[model samples]
Target: MQEFEPATDQLDEAWDAIQHVADLQDAWAAINPQGEQQRLDDQLDRNLVQDSDDEFAEMEVPELQSRQNIHQGDQPRCAIETCDPEITEEQAQHMMRQLNEKQRQVFNHVSKWCDDKARDQSVDPFQMFLTGGAGTGKSHVIKCIQYYAKKVFARMTESAEDMTVLSLAHLGTAAFNICGQTICSGLKINPKSQKEYKPLGEESLNTLRVKYRHLQLVIIDEISMVSTTQLTYIFGRLQQIKGTYTDFGNVSILAVGDFYQLPPISPPTPLCFPHDEILKDIWNPLFQIVELKEIMRQKDDAIFAQMLNRLRERKKKQPLQKTDKELLESRRVEENNLTAPPDALHLFYLNKDVDSHNERKLASLNTEMFTIKANDVDQRGGRIIQVHETPHRTTRADDTSLASYLKLAVDARVMLIANVDVSDGLCNGVPGIVKGIEFCNSQNMPIVVYVKFDSDRVGAKTRTTQFIPPHYAGCVPIKPRKESFKVRGRTFTTTREQMPLKLAWAVTVHKVQGQTTDQAVISMKGLRKSMAYVALSRVTHLEGMYLMDYDESRIFCNEDIEANVAKMPTCDLSKANPLTEIDHNTNFVIAHHNIQSLHRHIDDLKRTQK
Candidate 1:
């Protein structure tokens, strides 16, 4: 074959196309700092060039080269500086004023450390763990710190171009609650793999430095979900990225969570596991512990709150109390069809059950179904590929939160699968009802789905690009989200773009962790004691919780975790109760175990107790 020579016009066009791709990538990075899409796009461009005529092999475009050493002006701006909006100092101080005693104490300690660091970066950074039960304001304190940090950093940098505080959480919902990112994403970690993190080369280090130039404090929420191995990975990755050998590269840390809520997922030992030498070495010394004791959510029902607390830490020998059991039994739901509220979320133990329940509920809606297929691209070993969908099945993992195909209908109850807006309570696991679907102008694909959320305030104040129906003023418009993940048994990674929603007539207990629901229909089948507590606690009031197939057997706390938590140092909360002695001097009646001894006094006791 005659040697193929590229035409000058074609070469110039190709160069222009490459330049255009680079510009698009820069814009994409501004929105998505993870940069996975950009990397995949770059690989696709290279593969196309390689398959071109042989004469063009030797001609290389500089833009197509690796961006490791690109000029500073072209480097992506720090994610925090761009993604997060500014919080005025006045707003932060106002939040500080609203904190409870223990919350204010934690804030003062951490903010003081931040003040010291702002004055002198050479000082050793502060590390602390703030532990509390559900609804004790750990998340609220985190927000305050985040707002305060932004103001401090703005003052320090003088141009608001640098970020000094980073927020992370083990769960996406918790992360969004504080306007933060998941730990795996924030640290650039692979949750499935834990290869040793070696120091980066000069060029790579330079790039990392540019991205995290002024990161000083890290606030990690849902600390109980953080495992020993993951903790080590976090330290190692931060050390490497910061180019220092110090613990977490001398970055200050505030970890907040309760061990009694939920332990780490399997295959990874929890941070509270006593036998892990690595955890003991890294956690015990690196952080001071502060426990928040006030039960703010159930402030109106102190008796119920006390009962839940007793059950949360009940040991194997300390069986459930008769009074608590009777109270829970009173709220027991006899049947889903008869007693369960139409809007109450059914919390199940298994994913199969949740899916089946959701499907059944959706079919009951009797509306025209709408199917949305995910747009996916797979990358494996320097090759770009696609897993063709068969007539029956698609190539998505069964356990992944994201589905290959989402089926929805008008009036279908759905839950958000992604964090759209945290402050507005539009994060993952929030329930909503589909009102209408807006299709693309050119195609049948859905551009936005109108969802009237259970929380009316979710989209009330938020601005939207779509036209809202005057009658459905509270409906929020949800757009499709792009997610990147690897299948369990697959070698390739799949990047999918689809709507961030799931049929939410039913959901798993694990998904409801750290979320508060107004009403919940909880299934007690096959759930452990810890899981049962997590599910039950999601409902704010006892009257709002309806248990199906209630079993007291599934109500025991982890023995090891209980012991470890007992030994944890707690802040003296003597001042936490601001009430006077009269308010705190309520008398408690101890019930007699034996009827024989109390037989004579039974009549007297009944009159006095009543």
Candidate 2:
């Protein structure tokens, strides 16, 4: 009021300064939400704030709760805390105790009575030959020995030491994998030069040898599958690699298998004789032979097993017609004629018609069939058919409608057959149901009837079509038919290697030679032949083989029994032959010399290059 002359200018300056300060505050608040939020709204997006709080709170509670739970009680114990109910600890201890006693007695006897030479640090290695009938506990006993060795080694050696176990097979991909090492049956040596071209490096074979050198024992399963030549090669390689390490080299090798099974395939010669030197020397004094007599797999059906055993022992002689054989044959024929609800039949023909000019004309109808063989069907009356010519060829009266007839016999069953003539002609056995029929170009022009074949045989469901020719244009599907019959037929003989062309009824023994069957109705008549003897033995179990005739002589033969007994080599492991030590030393020395020569040759090459 006192400075009224310049009051207006002073008031304007204050107002402008206040406005600038307010603008600066607003810009700062915009960058920082918490500060702006307080001024903007009292309840600032409660949903967003509460959602985050709930998540973090939930996480915190669970962490604290879990910690508390862990502190509350100890973890649940293993199921094996107590002895197994089926086998008590006492029983196990008793069995183990007996085994241990036997082992100790043998060890004591060897330690006391064995010659001073045998007691030397360089004790000649002992080999074991374990043979057994199929399903015996041979493999189990060897596995037990391996387990014992592993335990003993673990107890004797440091904890850091490694161990390996291996089981090798004769063929295919089933091989042993242990501690980064694999032992397979066959080596891929060049056929022309039976030399080991693929060399093992220091990192591969040498490293494996080092890691497993201390291995106490090795158990070889299915030893029967190993050829004598292959065994000798493997043994030679092992001896060469471990020759320097006396302590680690003296590893135990246990082999278990049925000797009566298939033998090794050897090279052909003018006179057929066992060419395998190893096979001949299998009964060498170094081996400890153990034969397992207990049959485990066939224990459930003892009677049936005994019956099969008898049959296996029987000799091949003259055919004997028995009541069982007649009954089996009759049953087979009856099964073939059962054309009931589940077994429906359908037939298709490749209709061929010639024009007035004597020229061959293709039919408009076409079909294809797919068939799966049934195990019980009679060979003569079942779904088998022999095609006289290619499916494309013109159908004649004597052309043999075998395929067509088989299709009519079996109803509601699927059939798959190959080879169809014209694209427009009738195609039979192609999977799929006919949906609809239509014609194009001319109404009378050969109607292309499309047939779809449905099958899961080729992995997934598929549909294929065929074009019908003008000649068999009249062929059409029945309309609104109930309880329709679908016939299934198969072409027995074909030119293809995979497909068999001829189908005929034969005794099971004749057909199943060198083949395996889950269930077979074998005729006693066929059992008299040598081929039948081979066929019956193909099955692994007695239950797998069925006999049609129950003749004592058919199932058990004195000659066959004698033959098996003769095959069992008299392996006297206790006695030592004079040539044994000499042979072993000779083999070892030869291998050593060869290895030295190889090393010298390599060194010379390297020096020359430098």
Candidate 3:
């Protein structure tokens, strides 16, 4: 090429032409879908799906994938994903046969409703609040409904694989007791913002509809713990998911709980405390109450049962009878002498006291102390922003009770914070003794902790592990729990990997709400009267219950709750004939009846028209 000097104007024109062409290409790329896709592909190839980890981004990681799987219906919401082999048809039938007359009536009513639902009969959804005291065979009825009614639904639907029923509770421990899942987990609710529940995405809704297409019944265990606002959210969410405007999407609900126990947490009032007239209207029509009487737990001791019943509704200012005072005083034990029953569970009103007792008990044990830390990852908008090598110590964050750090010894007592297996009684709040620790080959961190559970049922199956003592037959190997929790004063969420266990020398009254212990030494110091009732009711018999301080002053139920409960209807055996009665006020006639009565009721309606 010949080197030639061009004019200044010509050179400037050529440079501008090149710049214009470059700008045109940039604009085309900005609008081109293919170009945008290519950019995404490149970003995904480098495992960097986000431009910034701190900001919101589309995630393709396994963690996010797993969460999506749950939303997509590939995973179950309740702990009863796999049916327990022990809950057989024969066993369920046998239990039903043994039910009391009142329990039998509930079973019959629910079973008939499930049958009607399966048959696609045009009827209103079944809604009932099964209320009872501490022990009125409510749990027994729940078992019967779960094991027996499921068969009816499966058989009628002609699909054994179809999910027909779900059991849910407000609290994790309560749900565990029922072999179910927490309401938030089962309903895909964001526990942090329960009152402000938003509708699920289209994809999630579609998947849930498919998953629960055959679902006819839902059993809510701790109904008392469910707040009015949360209850509304549940109803709205169900309606949205089922694509129906009807109450609870026409799904049958058997809400079982004792309102006399622990009420809903503050900021949200109890179901009885309807905030508005609209809510009150919805509440009255939504649920038909069935108050269960007859205390089954203390049936052997009728006197004690009567005493508990009397005390259940006792007013705050009411004086305890001399006999009641004498009985309670007889079980009083000095606070300093709690160690006499070395194995008895000590119940405290505060977590701090529980922690103090556990720490002191752990320190008293003569063994090597192992400080195990959790692997916590702080994430915001689907991307992990930071990793906490030594996480801040917290007893609870969100739903995960697993602490950031756990201190243990070989013989230190521990309690499960999660339900390892409910049917085997290896549920939350279960006590055990540390047998041994198995460390990972790559790190000093413990991979599994062997625990000798108090109940033989927990570790009945022999586990062939080298880490546990060869002589020990009831050792269960507990692995690290992986859960996400919201950190305080932080915008991001933290995913923690730690053992689902905590010191068990002492436990809080809140933890033992729906549980029963063989023997317990309870401290009612500084606790509300409602809390005192819950703590006292945990022991089946008065002989097994020991009070640190018998403060009868703090032993009464809420007066308003009592009045509300009194208005609730009890099951009448004479009226158990199903569909025999109809509401005269509503535009639609509501009926409660079995198959035989359905036709007769329709005939009666025809006769009345004449």
Q: Report the alpha-carbon TM-score of model 3 versus the true structure.
A: 0.74
How close is every model to the real structure, measured as TM-score? 0.71, 0.37, 0.74
Candidate 2 lDDT over residue span 1-610, tens digit each: 5566568678767755664455444566679855553433222111111101011121110000000001114221100001121244445334334332223222222222223222343444444556655544443344334433444455444554566343433321112111111123122211111222223333334654665555545555545445544454455445544654332146555555544443332321100123433333332333454565545545675653453344444445634345423432342313444222211111001011102111110112243322311111112112333423223221222122123112111111111122121121111122222323343564321133322222112111112332344542322221110110112332221221111011111112222221232334344442332333444443445443444333434433334334443444444433332232344334433334346557535642332221
Sorted by TM-score (best first), the order is: 3, 1, 2
**Full ranking by lDDT:** 3, 1, 2
Candidate 1 residues lying further than 4 Å off, grouped into runs, are 1-94, 198-208, 266-268, 275-280, 335-338, 371-401, 418-430, 438-500, 566-610
Which residue runs of candidate 2 sit more than 4 Å off their true CA positions?
Answer: 1-124, 156-161, 172-204, 244-249, 266-288, 311-610
Candidate 1: C-alpha lDDT: 0.64
lDDT of each: 0.64, 0.32, 0.65
Give the per-residue lDDT of model 3 (tens digit) for 54-142. 11111110000000011222221111112243576556656776677677778778776666666765656778889888878788889
lDDT by residue (42-109, candidate 1, tens digit) is: 34323211100111112210000000111323321101101223466566556666677677767766
Candidate 3: lDDT of 436?
Answer: 83
Candidate 2 lDDT for residue 362: 10
Judged by lDDT, which candidate is best? Answer: 3
